[model samples]
Target: MSSMRLTGTPSWLNIKQRSARPGGGDDPSRGPQEPVRRVWAIGGGKGGIGKSFLAVNLATVAARAGWRVLLIDADLAGANLHTCLGVRGGNRVNLSDYLYDRVVDIDKAAIDTSVPGLRLIMGALDHTGMAETSRAQREHLFQALRKLPVDLVVFDLAAGADRATLDFFLETDEGVIIATPEPTSIENAYGFLRAAFYRRLARTMSTSPIRDLIREAMDRRNERGIRTPADLFKEIGQLDRGEEARFRQALEDFRPRLVVNQVRESEEIKLGFSMRSVCRKFFGINLEYLGYICFDDAVWRSIKERQPLVLAYPQSDAALYIRRIVHKMLGT
Candidate 1:
């Protein structure tokens, strides 16, 4: 029998516990040595910014390039990613089934697409309640994604700044934020990043007195002029030197990449650079400008025909743009 020693400290202050990746070590599809997996979540501030379109075509292009990819339609309320991939009329296990426990395994629902190396775990748009996934379910699903055998996992997430949307955005290894040159889209894109930053900080410093300090900052944000990250950092350091390093580390690690879609002019392309600079100065979060895509009639034509753009028009300028984005994404 062992004597009970006094243990009165925050769990985080003690040894940090990492969540185990379920079945990730023995990936049956990839055999003994599993390849590295990359999970990319594509989201924008608004709809019609071409999040799903880019996601589907990128998956197709990557598959054509001889990489195994898995595309998940993360837009629970409006999951047309299956339609964009031309997956029609199949009674298959979807995200709903997995979430509701109709299926115990997530990989069991991965359906093969026309693209040889690409598989899809599709979502549902008809059941509006599907969007309200619990935090535990989301965490389990994310872990399940890591267990999949595919090299790349692309998530076409819903557009918004809601907790669900931002949760998916931050939960990924890296986030790909899509935005048009339009003013409203740009504004909302900033809004999304801002919310993500706060959410990250909130969760990171959740243990008091750091947690208590952050809560007070939130309550008195306007009164104390703690608007920018710089202001918050200064005040936090002044109050407690111990918490500053942790806060700085958390700030440095929240890097999100960007993509400008439907760019028609040089002026529009400059918006990406502008947004990057603004983020650095204001939020203190490093934003990588991945690249941009031009507006093309061929893309519209392909969409109207309900075909994957890269498959239908492989040599189109739009296809070349998609390839470039893929190269930069994989290179980074």
Candidate 2:
């Protein structure tokens, strides 16, 4: 039996502590709290990259290991994660209910799943306004997520590099980017990383003059010609030493995990490493290659049956790879 466990204060808790409100450490819930230990957000630049498949199976695998898990569909645009988890949605309270104040408690939106120790909070299905959630609303939702009575919370974020999507990706402890071995997918993945990297840098700069420069660099067509993060850092180093140090710290701290799905040939399996190298050389980012899942017929079959692959085909090659990825995330 695997002795791997994911319970306890997460490695990123120290970073959270630094930004935590003063004297806001205690849980105010009525009873003992089952504080969420880790959060994983699975997202990509484009749709159809198997993000939902990966999220559902990862949540299922963690739950089966006796850890309480909450799989939330953060994809407000196309909320089908309920279907992926084989849960029927019929007027059940969901994320929008909590966001829009229909439900005061986020726990009310939790729906029981077939897998024990696992629950789900469905995403907005019809609320078009959810895509434009205000910053306060997003922060409230994130605070509630930290207090959910589960060991892990996995967010199935929407596709694209929109501000809302990048915020969700940055807020989580583990930000996973799923992509395929196709040229278009790779291009979009790079775009997504650039957007996210700049977003993080902007958030790190507090009241600094370089903050405006970061914003300008976000626009690729800016007259400053600051195309990459390296170029921006070079400009910042010439401007202010204090801001330059902040930029260096943020660059070192921002590490996003990557997983290539539907991989087939050996070269495709090596795509993760190639991307990692390119990120280091071109973007000065440390991208962790968190293993990949091979192309398998069982993946689609599980989707067709509206069941998580780990549950529908536990013995399938895809399931095996998914479990391995989960273990890697757990650092076991």
Candidate 3:
């Protein structure tokens, strides 16, 4: 397949051409049906933590595995996934168009990537207002995303623990948090995880009283003295004994995956395990330590070339580790 570029015409809307098997991990012998779609969102609390790089390479690896993939750059203000995939930026329709009602169908914003079986929906690169869309608009976007025709949809979220980013992360089948071993990144990761867990609990609770209590707990300096999710659960149990079961269920459901990036030493990889332990003990949330990627020069080289590391340096150590991470995610 040739690389897709934005032209003066509106023909980019019909750019779905797969060079590999159409169905993702489905039995081709069976009768035709819609591919089983899976969604994963990659996010973090700190900027410059390599979330986009990981998202691009992960989508490429999945596409190479014969899964039709749609990678969406959900980072409205900091959009750069298109550049990562070697797609030109100018005059192209993007996610902002859909949110602002400039485009009626979400598929119209999806442009073909150089990688076969993989396409990209560029973020609202030049639209600062996109970061402040209403909840209704976001809901509409999520609903439209579900109907997208693809085996997998990966969202590269904007950095931070903002409500919009967290909502996108929580809505996906698998939410992966990417962080480095730096002290600041680790701290922000914990903060992001905390915000996500509280958000989940607030949404899970039906009673206004319980939700108000959760909101109180979310404030670090609140008079309630609720410093952690475990503390919040205790208060919830005391406030409404019948809600304990629901609270526990919410805790059981919020399992976010972690990926430690740019590891310079073997000891740095253990950060994932440490964060997992902290989440289990303090927040009562089961954070899965998906895997880690070691620092490699090939990563920078591929970025300079504007190609995915998996395709540009498949033999490099970082590339091997990335493919391993993808396999672990797919259970293959």
lDDT of each: 0.75, 0.82, 0.82
Candidate 1 clashes between residue pairs 3 or more apart in a chain or in different chains: none
Candidate 2 lDDT (Cα, 0 to 1): 0.82
For 171-230, candidate 1 gives per-residue lDDT tens digits of: 774788999999899988988887777777777774576666565555435677778777
Deviation from native of the Cα of residue 35 in model 3, angstroms: 5.8
Tens-digit lDDT string for candidate 3 (11-130): 211222222344534456632246435788998889999999999999999999877789989898999999988999997999888888999988888999999989998987685744
Candidate 1 C-alpha error for residue 210, in Å: 3.7
Instruction: Please give me the total number of clashing residue pairs in predicted model 3.
Output: 0
- What RMSD does model 2 have? 6.7
> How do the residues 176-256 of candidate 2 rate in per-residue lDDT, one tens digit apiece?
999899998989898999899999999988765788999999899999999889999999999988888999999998888
Candidate closer to the true structure by TM-score (higher is better), 2 or 3: 3
Clashing pairs in 3: none
Of candidates 3 and 2, the better by lDDT: 3
Would you give me the overall lDDT of model 3? Answer: 0.82
Worst 10 residues of 3 by lDDT: 1-10
Off by over 4 Å in 2: 1-34, 127-130
